[model samples]
Target: MRVWAKSGVAFNGVIAVVVGLGCALFALMAGLAWPAIVATSVALAGIAWLMTIRQDIRRHFVVKHPFPDEWHEILNRSVSFYRKLDEPAKRRFERDVQIFLGEQRIYGVEGQEVPIETKLLVAASAATLSHGRPDWEWGRTRDIVVYPKAFNDEYDVADGAKIAGMVQEHGPILFSDRDLKYGYQRSADGYNVGLHELAHVVDLEDGRADGIPGDLNWMAAMPWTDRIHKDLTNKHGRHLKRLLGNYAYTNEAEFFAVSVEAFFERPKKLEQRDPELYRLLSHYFNVDPRTGRVIEPVD
Candidate 1:
């Protein structure tokens, strides 16, 4: 129940040190700066102390799932993957969702409702990515900011340049509320923005996002790299496009994310079209997910 990820704690430590030194340097350049330097050092010391106690505070609040029946009903309706699970697995998923909700915050944009449904949907995306790795945590993520429509880094409402979702190394993950709901509501389009972005978070776990996620060993990494290289740089060019769709060809990270969406949503289709890549993802995720056995109740 650590509040900060290992990397995040280290990053914060580095920031504190850098800020202290920079303040000291600026004070030294001025004549009467001892008081300023003392104040800066004290502030940074407070920051360091807060960082040290963050984990303790987080541990104090961690608890088992306490969601009511209404929440489970929402899951049964919107989250097909959860609906397919047996009672035990469903409980496990619910536990994971509760854990995630406790650990991270989800903020809505422009007075949008951050209801239990929204929180559960976000949790389902996280649970699906880390179901194989129970120890996996989103400690690096501080919050998930959801905009009503699409937005850019500057929060501009771009038309054609609209972004569906994005995961950042040093900032909150961003999502469009409209697109996020669509991703789950549509279910099987192989276009889940939430899952796609969460997959990037998985890739970032090993401190990098260069096509290889943290789940793979060097042995698996090597072959995955080779396959990606062959596909991305192939002379036939459009063959990879045909196999994985156009967005995947944008880059290696996108390829992995797009493949993850397809892996979960259209596993059989992916296996039929590109069995090798499908097997790679299947091994990485540790589930076939080819049955497509979700029970989406007709409204």
Candidate 2:
């Protein structure tokens, strides 16, 4: 696995080099005649970008807790399922995890600092859900506000109802730390409030949270909608007692978020129960949880 991972990194390096050369040649043609100097500068810039992105990605997927060694064992046991990810994916996950954790400020209702382990668990789950897409828009929405426990905020009930955490039209995310920690520690069995809310953030990427990722082209969007709707109907109609969760059936946006949690937390179960929905998610995310591999889908 290490050799394979090394080879993959080398391959990416080669590609980056080729792209750098191409950019330099283009610049020369456009009158920046210093080919050698230009190529070298561009190559260095490319390398820097790649490194930055790698760190950013790792920050989004892995979290480090300030606890004793014994606690590490417990956290590992809690997230043992994450071993399904290959090294490259794990690297990316680590970067994303760090990024996710770095952004959030966790506090108790009384304004005390929450335990790092609690925040780590919540951030880990968020990283797992968002890891599939390197281009995920929510990746840029730094700062997750986690309450030590379930807390409430003033909401305009007349407008859309606000649950635990909400992704405002243009605002930071709100989360119940107690709910997030409990949900992820329990093997992500029930609805993940973190993922649920993050899903809403991703859906808003297309400029509106209308239950659609506008970033998805029509081809991807069609299948995504079809499979999700079919699964929802089957589960809600009593034919399938609920492969996802009841919250998923609340609306299209919630359904997308709920599906994301299931995709990462229980890939095999989801595949066994709803193959089509699994396939759609795998396609859109460009990663297959079942195989921990990224390959283009054949038409």
Candidate 3:
């Protein structure tokens, strides 16, 4: 993973250097004209900016939790599934884990201190699940507010009411630590609310958490919508029992999240029940958890 991370940095550095030198040469060939110098400088500046961005991204996305050595071993053991990634993907996954952790601020709400390592493990697992798609952008979720246990909150409505765990109007994701830890440890069997929520974040990449998997273009979006509609309808018809949880049927966003949990936790089942849906997810995610190549199954 270290080698892979270094390689990414090296690759970006080489590109920056090449572009910078090219601009300098272009300026010289243009007879040192003021316009040419300015253009070359701007080009060089752009390369430098990109290099800084890459470094910052790496720093933000890579996990560096200050846990005890024993805790590190425990996390490494729990996530043995991560090994299925190829070298490059593994490094990228590490980087994403770091970014997820760095972006979120976890607080102990009930005078019960939550271990940072525990939070890191949960966030890392969720981030690793989506590392394949580097293009998916979800900057709105800036933090993860965790309660030691399930807690309640008050909110205003038409009749003035209160809710718990209701994803706020525009704020961080909130999860009970108990639920998060349980989902992490046992959900390898297929129930992962963390991954489910993160999937909603990914689906929101297109600017709405409406169950539409954000695609790069209109043509891509068309096929994605068709696939989702067909799969959901087929499941509804009893032609196919839903491989994803019943919660998935709640809405588009929930469907996307629940589907993600099934994809990562029960890939073979999804493959058997809905081959087309499995294929679509595999293509979009660029990784197949069922292969056991990047992340090995837990014993």
- Measured by lDDT, the strongest candidate is 1
The residue-by-residue lDDT of candidate 2 on 1-299, one tens digit each, is 11113244566667777777777766767776585658675767588558735743454333443334544454466554356666766555555555555655555444557677766666566665555655453444445666655554563222333455667766766676667766666664645676667777778777776576768877768877776677556643542236675677777787787777787667787777777777777776677766656655311
| lDDT against the true structure, each candidate | 0.73, 0.62, 0.61
Candidate achieving higher TM-score, 1 or 3:
1
Top model number, TM-score: 1
Report clashes for each candidate as comma-separated counts.
0, 18, 13
Compared with the true structure, what per-residue lDDT tens digits does model 3 show for residues 73-190? 5556555445555665555566556565555566665445768666776566565555655544446355666655555553222132222233443567666666666666774667
Model 1 ranges off by over 4 Å: 1-65, 110-113, 234-240, 291-299
TM-score of each: 0.73, 0.64, 0.68
- What is residue 161's positional error in candidate 2, in angstroms? 14
Query: What tens digits encode model 1's per-residue C-alpha lDDT throughout 46-124?
Result: 6775676576446445533366899888888987677667776676667667678876878887657776676778888
Report the alpha-carbon TM-score of model 1 versus the true structure: 0.73
Sorted on TM-score, best first, the list reads 1, 3, 2
Worst 10 residues of 3 by lDDT: 155-164
State the displacement of the C-alpha of residue 163, model 1, in Å, after optimal TM-score superposition.
Answer: 0.7
lDDT of candidate model 1 versus the reference: 0.73
